[model samples]
Target: MSTPSATPATPAARQSLTMVCATMAGAIPMMTLVLWFVLAVDGIGEFPESWPLLVVLAAAVGAYSICELVGFRTPPLQYSNRPTAEVQADSWRRFTASTFTRFAVCEAVFLISVTLAFVADSFWVVLLGAVIALPLFFWEAWPGERNQRRFAAALESGGIPSYLTGRAQD
Candidate 1:
C-alpha cells in the first residue's frame, strides 16, 4: 500500500540512479590510473601494457557495479537507518560495516591498480588510476555525511536535462 507520493523513486530519480551507475562505472579506472603510472615509472615489473591490465581492470570494476545494480542490493558502503530505528547498537554496526567496506574496497582498488601497473609497465594507466581513486577515497572518506551533499550535486548536475534550459513554466 504505497502511494505515488510514497514511491521511493520518481522518473527524475530514475534518471539520477542511471547516471550514478554510469558514473560509478567510470570512476573505477580514474582512481587506479595514478598508481599504475607510478609502477610503470620505476620499471618494477607489473608488466601491464602488453597484458592490457587497464582493460581488465575496467572490466572487473564494471562487472562489480553491474552486479550491484542487477541484484538490487545496498552498497557495502553508505549508512541507512533501515536495520533498527529502535536500537543504538544496530545503528552503529551498520555504520561501521558501511565505512569499513568502502575503505577496504577503495584501498584494494588503489593497490590493485599499482600492482597491475607495475606488472604491465603502463605508467599512464597507473597514474590515472591512482588520481581517480584518491578523490573517490576522499569523497567516501569524510568524517560524517559530507559526501552525501557532493553525491547529490553529482547526480543532479551530471544528468542535466537538455530540455530544462531557456524557458520557464507559466
Candidate 2:
C-alpha cells in the first residue's frame, strides 16, 4: 500500500497566518487613534477618580498576563497516533487558535484602556495602560521564526525538534 506523504503547509495558509498576525498588531495603532480622537473632542475631564477604574485596569493587566502565561506554557495540540498531514494540520490549527486567543486578550486590554480614557477623560491613565499592554502584545502575539518552529515541532512524532532545519514536511 502506498503511504500518504506529508507536505509543508501551503503558501496560502502561511499568508493567512501572516495576515492574522498583522491584524492583531494593528490593534495597537487603531486604539491609539481612537483614544486621540476621543481626547481631542472631549478633553481630559477629571483625574484621581474612583478606585474602581484603577482596579479594572489592574485586573485587565493581570488577565493579560495570565493568558500569555498559559498560552506559552500549554501546547494547544497534543501528539496523537494519526496521519502526518492530519497531525500537522491540527498543530497549525492549534497554533492559530492559541495565537488568536492571545491577540484577543491583548486587544481587549487595549480596548479597555481606551474605554477608561474616554470615560475618565484621563490621558495619563490610558497611556499607562498602553505602556504596559503594548509590550506584552508584541512579546506574546508577534509570530516570529521561533514560534513557527515551535508549532512545526509539535507535529513531529517525537516532538523534540525545536527548529526545522530544512524544508518543512508535507
Candidate 3:
C-alpha cells in the first residue's frame, strides 16, 4: 500500500464528483423537507411517549459515528494490486457506494425524526433530528475538499491510484 500524497485533482474529475455530491446533497434535504412539510400539515397524530425522542437522538449520533469510523475504510483486496482500469473503476464504485451509504444514514436520522413527528405529533422531534443530521450531512456527506482528500487517502492506502480520486502524486 502506498501513502497518498496531497495533490490537486484534475479539474474535470473534480467537477464531475463535485456535481455528484452536490446533486445528492441537494436531493436528500429536499426530499426530507417535503415529507416533513406534508406530515406536519396533515399527517401528525398524538402519541404520549417522549422516550422515543431521546432514543432517536442517541441512535442518530451512534449511527453517524459508526459510519464515519467504518464506512470510509476499505481494506486492500487481492484485486487492488492489479492497478488496471478495472481496479480504478472498482475503486470509484466503492468510493461512491460508501458516500451514498453515509448520506443515507444521515438522511435516515432525519426521516426517522420526521416519522416520530407524525407519531408523536411533535415538531420538536424533527428539529432535534435536523440539528443532529444537518451538520453531519455537511461535514461528512458533502464532497468538500477535506472529505475528498480523506477518501483519496483511504483509496490510495488500499492500493487504488490517486488519479481515480482526482489526486496526483506529490
Q: Whose TM-score is greatest here?
A: 3
Model 3 over residues 1-170: C-alpha lDDT tens digits? 99776764455544666688777667656755666676556554344377768867877887778778985787643433555556656656666677777888777887788777777776667767777777777777766666766776776774536555554323
Instruction: State the lDDT of candidate 2 residue by residue for 10-88, as single tens digits.
Output: 4454568878788767767777767766675556434547653675577566766666456654443444567655555
Q: Which digits, one per residue and each the tens of the lDDT, describe model 1 over residues 1-170?
A: 85565423223423443354446545556654444445544653434454545554674475345423331223222334433222223323433444445545554555665666556566654554555555555555322334333323322343321111111111
RMSD of each: 13.7, 6.8, 6.3
Best by lDDT: 3
Candidate 2, pairs of clashing residues: 6-170, 7-169, 7-170, 8-170
Tell me the TM-score of model 1.
0.40
TM agreement with the true structure for every prediction = 0.40, 0.65, 0.70
lDDT of 2: 0.61
How many backbone overlaps does candidate 3 show?
Answer: 0
Winner on TM-score (1 vs 3): 3
Candidates sorted on lDDT, descending: 3, 2, 1
Model 3 residue 26 CA deviation in Å: 2.7
* Displacement of the residue 113 alpha carbon in candidate 1, Å: 1.2
Q: Which ranges of candidate 3 are over 4 A from the true structure?
A: 1-14, 28-50, 77-88, 158-160, 168-170
